[model samples]
Target: MPDGNGTFVKDFFIVGFPGLHSTYYFLVSAVLCLVYIFILIANGMFLFMFATNKCLHKPMYFIYINLVLSDVLFSTSTLPKIIARYLFQDGTISFSACFFQMYLVHYFGAVSSYTLAIMAIDRYIAVCYPFGYHAIMSNRNTLILSIVIWVFSHPISIMMVVRAFPLPYCGTNTIIHCYCDHVSITRLACTDRAPYSFPAFVFAMVILLGSLAIIVFSYSFIIFAVLQISSTHGRLKTFSTCSSQLIIIALFFLPRCFNYLAANVGITFNANLQIVIILLYSLLPPMINPLLYSLKTEEVKKILISKLKKHQVHLTVLS
Candidate 1:
């Protein structure tokens, strides 16, 4: 293990976005910034609708609101920092700031994973034991679950943060990605230790793989239940509601799990693959969530369209 606690690694290098001419990179950045703006707006709307709408005050929507909140936080912690570094060309952060960024990134990432686990449990109760769904997944229980996620994530994230600070880094401090991720910094550590790497892998397993296993197990039962529905219409109706969530979860989980698992095993990850993986993880999940709800959900789509038309009407009236 490398050890450079007191001024061993002074500076780091960040190799911004891969394979774009300066002009092309600028154009891409403009588009990405616009996309991020929409992510904020759309996720905000989900949170607001869940809060304000009486009809949406249910366990399912409650978890959805948490999911949106987690997604927003995850993006907020990571993307803006990346954009500032790569797109804006201001790629410098102090040691403390870097650690803070890493901590928050892991914090929110853990939150999102735990939130997904709660959603999986919610789905299990709703689909598998429909009669007890209300009593089992009550608002109180959901709140408790959310609280547990935050509490559990904090200590685990803090462990990673604690281990990272002791490394004596006097060499390059440039991070290859936009954010101060653990992997990039770990590789740059002057004094590496099994503790840092192992804890990170442990957290990833607990949060990422643990949640994924729950999802798979719950959905397996769900699929069985769906198949048992006597009516084809009933089957389709049940499947339709869950399909979007399944897609969203898979998109969110697969690449992230792959990236981390590969990295943990000491694989030399391809930078180009990293960009694609990170982009999909960061952008696609948020981009698709609103689309899934608005497109596949009849009620949500109707409401969204109505809202759009109402805005148009207001403009027309003013004009």
Candidate 2:
């Protein structure tokens, strides 16, 4: 369906802080700018270290590389546009571009979820069946798993975006959220949005909850396995390996649970608080994950420190 001009709504205005005073726009934009910078620098360093350090050429590190890649891509998909909207006072996004962004936002998100589950599986094998971990999680198999996660996660997002694009959109074109998403776009349809919204919601649950179930299963076995260790120090060491991963998974999944439950179960809460939680959880994992791994994982941290020492020694020699 087309409007008077015989075309769908060509563009949409992204509304950030709908009733925010104009005075606070710059302050908001500046803070977001700092966050975007940190996300890039932090994730970028992990990617660099993974590629350059031969010590990181194992199945576990390979999975982490994909996670880093997803975080970088996911952050890039939405942050720049939001920042530009606040700073330049331009919120208009072409209709096609909005859909494109929406697709990416979910695509990378799904990939990250699946990859995290795969990582848990990796850890599960390493701990519970250490003798067979290598045979079970070969480097070639790890690479293939990463590739499969990226490729297979595309279709659901594709279906959601394609379903929404051709529907009649004659009324208000303002998307109330900071970014375009399946829900935001479908909610704008002039016709009843049930067909697209229902299928999309089902798929969203399958991906988010399905991946989460796998993680939960893996960790249950992990906990039981840890408890059976004969020595207290041995139990502590094994648990230490999973501490950062547990933190990362909790931050990733908990807010998502709150969000989906609020939508489906008809729970009442502040709309602003909902937005804050979504934004915080999405950005929080990426921001903190690099620091968590570098500090918590001894091998990577040692390699990083060693590289820094070498660089300093080289500088001193030059001086």
User: TM-score winner among the candidates?
Assistant: 2
Runs in model 1 deviating more than 4 A are: 1-7, 10-13, 18-21, 193-195, 312-319
**Model 2 lDDT per residue over 65-156, tens place:** 88888998998999889889889988889989999999998999899899889989998999999999999899999999999999999999
**Global lDDT of model 2:** 0.88
- By lDDT, the best candidate is 2
Q: Worst 10-residue stretch by lDDT in candidate 2?
A: 1-10
| lDDT per residue as tens, model 1, 1-319 | 2224455654454555655567766676677688789899998887776666677777777777767877787778766665665577666676787788889888888887777777777877787898998999998888888788888888877888888877867655666676777777786776655667877888777788888898889889889999999999999988787888888788888888888888777776578667667877877887778777667766667677878999999999999
| RMSD after Cα superposition, model 1 | 3.1
- Please give me the total number of clashing residue pairs in predicted model 2: 0
| Model 1: residue 250 alpha-carbon error in angstroms | 0.4
